[model samples]
Target: MSKVVFITGASSGIGKSIGLYLHGKNYKVYGTSRNPSKVNVPFSMVALDVTQKESIKRAIGEVIGIEGKIDVLINNAGKGITGPIEDTPTEEMKFNFDTNFFGVIDVIKEVLPSMRLEKSGLIINTTSIAGYMGLPFRGVYSASKGALELVTEALSMEVKSFGVRVVNVAPGDFATNIAAGRYHTPVFENSAYKEKYAENLALMDSHVSSGEDPMMMAKAIYEIIKSKSPKIHYKVGGFMEKFSIILKRVLPDKIYEKLLMNHYKL
Candidate 1:
């Protein structure tokens, strides 16, 4: 039987691109979206809101029922929220975790039973370089991804003996819907962080607008899954992320912060 892969947030962006890439590679693909009507991908479509456990449960159940086996589970459904930490609402921060962190956990928990029963599977959590370096106004988004990065590391160890693998894909900056409403800072009222916000938003917007094609990320993900043993974490995208990673390691903290501020025109 052909192997099957289940992907969340497959309606568009990198998730959708990954689904298409894998499908074209001959894997039976199951794609999920909150609005199934908006998903026009050639793969199977099911309604799923990653923020809701029930939605994830139902979607996975459907995939298992039809495919009888899930060789891979890609937790690609996520969003971004950018603003001063103080200006970010309590509910907004919670919503970010609800969708980006806990949502992936819910899907993993729902799918793992079958994976363990079969004694094999691969899990991919789509994260960002933000997981490593917390951006100025992306506290919530970074925190959510940071949480996932920790989960990915610890869970990889936890599941290694079970013949299941957990990995994280941290893309630097890519053209995707993840930045649709969140990357840009809103004009704040009485906000003392306005200059910082403006500078960060401008940097984020420029990087996102000119970032690597989503296809590069999708292809990288495909290659990882095809490997006999995937790494615990892989960084995608290009030079910007690579440079950030190196700078975070070599530069003094104060110097790095200064460089980032100047580079972003803050």
Candidate 2:
């Protein structure tokens, strides 16, 4: 039997591309959205709001009923929040964490039992390069992804003995419909960072709009899935973005900060 793959946030963007690509590769792919009815993809669709525990359980149950076991689980559901950290409201930050961090945890908890029983599974998380370096106006979004990356790292060790592998795929800018889902925190008229926030937000959006094709990410994901033993982290994107990860690790603290400030024109 072919491997069964379940992916979240598949109504559009990178998740949708991954689903379609995997389907073409003969995997029995199951994709999820909060509202599956609106998803017109060729693979199976499940209604899953990753932030809701009941929704996660129901969706996983439906898949298990048909496939009996989930060979791969891709936690791709996430949202973006942009604003100066001080200006970002508490509720907005919570919402970002809800979707990007807690949501991933919810689905992983639901699917782990079956994976543990089988003594084998692959859990791939879609993190971001922004997670490594806190971008100027996207602090919360970066925090969310960074937290997920840490969780993925720790999970790899915790589940290793159970025969489950966890990996984080951190992508730089990618062309997707994420702009629509991104929430811009309200900037008060008297805020100190208002003007700089606006300029930085615009620059970030432009980078996303002109990002590399989503297919590159989808292809990278496929290779990881097909590997006999995949690494714990995979970085995918343009040269500078990929190199930034290495630079951040090796560069002096003040020098790296200067490079980041210069890149964002801060």
Candidate 3:
């Protein structure tokens, strides 16, 4: 039997691409959106709001009911939040963590019981290259995804003996509809960061508009599933985007900060 794969936030964007690609490859793919009925895709679509625990439980139960077990769990559901740290609302940051961090944990916990019982499973987290660094105007998003990356590392060790594997796949920007959905603190007129924040926001949108294809992520994910011993972390993106993570590791704190500031034209 094909492995059962469950993905969150699959209505569109990277999540959609991963789901479609896996379905085409004969994996039993079940993806979730807040309202799955609205989206037409080859894979099964279920309703799941990551921000709601009950929704997560119901979605996982529905999949387990049909498949008996979820061989792979992909935590791709996430929210994007961007603005200067001072200008962005604290509540919005917490909300982002709820979706990008807490929600992911909830989904993983719901699936672990079945996975542990089966003594075999894979959990792949869809984090961001941005998660590796604090990018301008996107600090909250970075924090949320970065936290997930750390959790993936810790969870991998905890579940190793159970025969369940965990990994993080951090993707660079991809052409997607994320910009339209993310919370953007209004460009307050009198605020100190008015001009720069407005400029950076547009730049951010353009980067996504011109980003790499989401199918690349799908293909990378497919390869991981086929591997017998996949690494703890897999990065899928352009050379420079992937290299930036390396640079962060090697460079001094101030120098790295300077490089990012220059890139953002701050």
Cα lDDT computed for each candidate against the true fold:
0.86, 0.93, 0.95
Q: Give the poorly placed runs of model 3, Cα more than 4 Å off.
A: none
Off by over 4 Å in 2: none
Write one digit per residue (lDDT tens) for candidate 1, span 1-266: 66799989899988899989999999899989888887788888899999887888888988899888799999998888888888878888888898999999989999998999999999999998888877778878889999999998999998888899999999888887666757444658688988778777767778788888899988998898889978898898787677787899999999999987787665
Worst 10-residue lDDT window for candidate 2 reads: 179-188
Please report, as a residue range, the 10-residue window in candidate 3 with the lowest summed lDDT. Answer: 34-43
**Alpha-carbon RMSD, each predicted model:** 1.4, 0.9, 0.7
Question: TM-scores of the models, in the given order?
Answer: 0.95, 0.98, 0.99
Q: C-alpha displacement of 194 in model 3, angstroms?
A: 0.6
Q: Looking at candidate 1, what is the lDDT of residue 175? A: 80
Comparing 2 and 3 on lDDT, the stronger one: 3
Clashes (N, CA, C under 3 Å) per candidate:
0, 0, 0
Candidate 2 displacement at residue 14 in angstroms: 0.5
Highest TM-score model number: 3
* Most accurate candidate by lDDT: 3
Model 3 lDDT per residue over 16-90, tens place: 999999999999999999988899998899999999999999999999999899999999999899999998989
